[model samples]
Target: MKVHIHVSLKSGVLDPQGRAIHHALEGLGFAGVNDVRAGRLIELDVDDSVTDAQLDEMCRKLLANMVIENYRIEKVGEKENA
Candidate 1:
């Protein structure tokens, strides 16, 4: 099975890197760029037998830092479907 995880900073958090990128984009003549928020996408190929609970545990344990970021997990194709 395939797992797609998206981890992003919560609202009201400061994102210096995203701000820098937004500035750079405006410099490149990209107008109307209001804001930018950067996040991470993690893809994992695991056994089909892996449960949702297990995947959630994996995200909390290693994939995402629960302190500053929130994580959402999505299960993609199973081995047979793939």
Candidate 2:
């Protein structure tokens, strides 16, 4: 099975990288960007036996820092994962 993990900062947390990008866009006079937020995407190819509970545990334990970051787990179909 293919698992896609999207990790991002929770609201109210400061994102330095996002701020930098916003600044850079303003510098370039792009002006349309009101705000910016950055996140990470991780695609994993796991065995069919891997369960949802186990995948969520993996995120909570090692993939994301639950204190500041939130993660979403998406199961991709084989056609898409391929």
RMSD of 2: 1.3
Residues 6-51 of candidate 2: C-alpha lDDT, one tens digit per residue: 9999999999999999999999989789899998999999999999
In order, what lDDT does every prediction score? 0.89, 0.93
- Score candidate 2 by lDDT: 0.93
TM-score of every candidate: 0.89, 0.90
**Worst 10 contiguous positions by lDDT, candidate 1:** 73-82
RMSD in angstroms between candidate 1 and the native structure over all alpha carbons: 2.6
lDDT, model 1, position 19: 97
Candidate 2: 10-residue stretch with minimal lDDT: 73-82
Show where candidate 1 strays beyond 4 Å. 78-82
Candidate 1 C-alpha error for residue 31, in Å? 0.8
Predicted structure 1: clash tally: 0
Model 2 / residue 71 / CA error / Å: 0.5
Candidate whose lDDT is highest: 2
